[model samples]
Target: MGAGHAHKLYRPAHSPVHALPPHCKIAAVLCFVLAVVATPRTALWAFALYALLLAAVAAAARVPAGFLLKRLLIEVPFVAFAVLMPFVATGPRVHILGLSLSESGLWGAWNILAKGTLGVAASVLLAATTELRGLLLGLQRLRMPPLLVQIASFMIRYGDVIADELRRMRIARLSRGFEARGVRHWGVLAKSAGALFIRSYERGERVHLAMVSRGYTGTLPVPDAAPATGGQWSRAAALPAAALAVCLLGWTL
Candidate 1:
C-alpha cells in the first residue's frame, strides 16, 4: 500500500480536517466515547446513533470507505471480547437463537462493543486529520506525562524503520524454505526473533548517537504553535455532541 493507505496513519495534508489542532480533536472524541460507553446498552437506538455519528465523521473528514473499513477492523479484538463477555460472565442466562446468553452480561457486552468501535473510529479520525508528530505535540499540550510523550515520540519516529526491517526479514524468510508451520520450524523462528531484537537494539543506539551529534536536547521538542483554530474545535465537536444527544434521547424514549 502507498503511504496514504499504509495503516491509515496520520500525515498533514491540505484537507480541511487536517487543519484542526490535535488536542481539540482528542478531547472532543474522547468525551464522545466516554458518553457512549457510559450509556446503557439496552438503549439500542443510542448504539445505532453512535455508529451513524462515526460514519458522519468519516465522511466529513473525507476518509475513503476502504480506509474507514480498515480502521473498523482494528476494533475486532474489542468486539470479540465484548461478544464473549455474555457467555463468560456470570449472570442470568437466556436463550437467543438457540444459544445461551446472559441478560446483564449481554447488555454489558453490547456496551463494550459500541464503545470500542466508536473509540477506534475516533482514533482513526485523529490520525487521518493530524500528523503523527502533531498529535504528540497535542499530547504534550494536554499535559500527558512528559516521560510518556517522550517515549511515544521516539517510538513514532522509529516505528516505520522497525516495521520496514521486519518486512525485509519476513521476505527473506519467505524466500527461503521456511514454512512457519511446525515445532522444528519454530526454533529457527525463535533465533530469527533474537537476531531481529539485536538488530533493533543496535539501530536504536545508532539513532540516539546520530541525534546527539545533531544537537539533541534532553527532551524532544515540538512547534509551540499548531494551525488548529477554535473553529476547528466546533466542527469536530459537532460529531460527539450529536452522538451524546442521541444517547440521551434513547434514554428518554
Candidate 2:
C-alpha cells in the first residue's frame, strides 16, 4: 500500500511502544491475547489484573484513555449479544432484580465481555502504534502468505479510491434528480453498483498489464529487513511476558 494509505488508527508518537519494531509488536500482541484467552472466566480478579496490564502499556505508549474507550464502542454489538445471553441461555436460572436469568448464561456473558473487551483493546492499541504498511510488513516478516498480504495491500491502497468513486456516483445520481426514496430506487442503485464493479475490474486489468510490461514477477520485491535487535525483542517481549505471568496466577489462584 502507498504511504498515503496510512490508517487513521495510527497515532504518531515517539513512545517506547510506538518505537518497537512492527513484527515484535505483532508477536507481543498475539502472545498477550493468547494469555488473555487462556484465563478462566471464573477468575474475576485475573481479569482486573489483565486490564491493569493493558492500562500500563497504554500509559507507556502515551495512548489516551478516552481515545481507547471511544474506540471500544466497536464492541457494542458483541456486548449486546452477551447481554441477551442471560435471557436466552437454557439451564438453571437465578433471580436478579425479580427477573429470572440463567446462571450459566451470566458466566458466559462475563466470559465474552471480559475476553472480547481485552482483545479489542489490545487490537486498538496495536493499530494506534503501528502504521498499516508497517503491519503488512510485519505480517510478511512473520511469514504470512504472500498472496494474503498482497491482497490486503491492494485493499488498503484502493479502498479510498473505491469510496471516492461511490461518492461521485452518488453525486451524479443526485444531480439527475434521484432521491432514492424507496424500493423504486433500488434498480438505479443496483445498476450503479454493477457499473462500479465493472470499472474496478477494468482498472485492475490495466494495472496488471502495466505490471507485466515492467517485468513484474509473481512475488513482490522484498524490502531490506531491519530485524529487531535482541534488546528490542526483550523490551517488546516484556508486555506479553507480564501478561503470561498474570495468566498463570489466574489459573493457579
Candidate 3:
C-alpha cells in the first residue's frame, strides 16, 4: 500500500500513551464520549472543561500539535452539518444576517456542534494513543460482539491490501491510455471492477486456507503484557473523570 494511504491511520509509537495497555485507553475513551454526550447543550463551561481535558490527554501522549489538528479536522463535515441545522430546522423564526430562521434550529445546531466536536476529539485522542492492532485487541477485550470485532479485524488487516490493488489497477489503466472522463470508458471500468472483486475474493480464500494450514484459530490472542505504569493510568483516567464531573454539573444545575 502507498505510504500516503496509511498516513493518517494509527501507527505504532513509543510515547507514554502508546505504552499503556490498549484496554485502559479504550475504556477511558468510551466513558469520555458518553459523558460528553450526556452533557447539556447549553452548558458552555462544561464543554470547555471537556475540551481542556482532552487537550491534556493529547499533550501527555506527546502527539504533535499539527498532527492532532489535522486528525481532528476529520469531523469537520459533521460539524458543518450541525452548524447548518440552525438555518434549516423547523421552529419559530429568528433573524440572523437578514435571513429569518428557526429558534429551535439554532439550538439544534449548537447541540450537535458541541457534542460532535467533543466526541471526535475524544476518539482522536484514543486513536493517537494506540495503534490499530492494539485498538482491535482492546475492542475484543471489551466484550463487544465477537462477530463485529472479527469483521473490524479483517477490514483493518486487508484494507491496505485492497487499496494497493486499486492503485495498481489505476496505474495499469492509465498506462493503456485509458482516461476516465466520460461514458465511453464506462463499460470497461465496470468490468475492471468486477475482475478486481473476483481477484480480492480469491486472495481472501487463499489467506484463509494458509491460516488454517498453520493452526489458525478464530480469535486473535493478546500476549502476556505488563500493566501500565502509574503515570500512564493517571493520564488515561484524567480526561474521562473531568468530563464526567463536568457533565454531572451540567445536568444538576
Candidate 4:
C-alpha cells in the first residue's frame, strides 16, 4: 500500500501513543469503544470516566484539547439527532422548565449523545495519532480483507488528487465568470459532477492498466511494519482494560 500521504487528521507527534505499533493502537481503540458501548446508559458516571480516559489519552498523545474538540465537530449531526429525540420519541413524560418531555426520550438522547460522542472522540484520537498509511498497515496486520484494504489505500492516496481536480474545475468556472448562487445553477453543478466522474474513471482505467503492465495482482504488496512487542501490547491494552473495569463496575453497581 502507498505510504506517501498522511490524512489531514493526523498530527505529527513523538508521544508514546504515536510510537506504539498501529495494530496495537487500533485494537486498543476498538476494545475501548466496545466497552463504552456495552456500559449501561443509566450509569452516567461511567461515561464521565470514559471521557476522562480519552482525555488522558489525548494528553499522553500530546494532542491539544482544542485539536481534539475541533475534529469532534464532525459528530454534530449525531448530536442534532440526539437532541431531537427528546421532542419526538414516544414514552413516559416528565416536566422540566415548564415544558413536558418524554422520560424515555431523555434517556434515549443521553444514550446517543454519550455513546456517540465517546465513539467519535475515540475515532478522532485514533486518526490524530496514526497516519492514513499506518491505519491501512494496521488493518492489514489485523488480517482485514486485502481487497478492502486496497480500496482504502487507493481512497487515501487519490482523495487529495480528486479534491485538487475539483478545485481546478471550480477555478476554471469562476475564471469564466460563472457564479452559482441559486437553484438555477443545479444543472451546471450536476454536469460538472458528471464530467469529474468520467475524468476520474478514465484516470483509474489508465492507472490500472499501467499497474497491470507492471504485473499487478489482485492484492497490494504489504509493507514491512514491525509487530507489536509483549510490552507494547500490554501497554496498549491498558486503556481497554481500565475501560473494562469501569464497565463491569457500571454493570455491578
For 1-253, candidate 2 gives per-residue lDDT tens digits of 3467777898998999998889999999999999999998999998898999899999999999999999999999999999999999999999999999999999999999999999999999999999888899999999999989998988888888888999999999999888898998899999999999998999888888998899987789979777899999999999899989989998898
How many backbone collisions does model 3 have?
1
RMSD to truth, every model: 3.4, 1.5, 3.0, 1.8
Stretches > 4 Å off in candidate 2: 1-3
Clashing pairs in 4: none
Per-model TM values vs. the true structure: 0.81, 0.95, 0.87, 0.95
Evaluate all candidate structures by whole-model CA lDDT and list the values in order. 0.77, 0.93, 0.79, 0.92
Error of 3 at 69 (Å): 2.1
**Which model, 1 or 2, shows the larger TM-score?**
2
Task: Candidate 4: list runs displaced more than 4 Å.
Answer: 1-4
lDDT of model 3, residue 11: 47
Clash pairs, model 1 backbone: none
Clashes of each: 0, 0, 1, 0
Clashes by residue pair, model 2:
none
lDDT by residue (tens digit), candidate 4, 106-202: 9999999999899999999999999888898899899998888998888778888998999999999999999999999999888889999998999
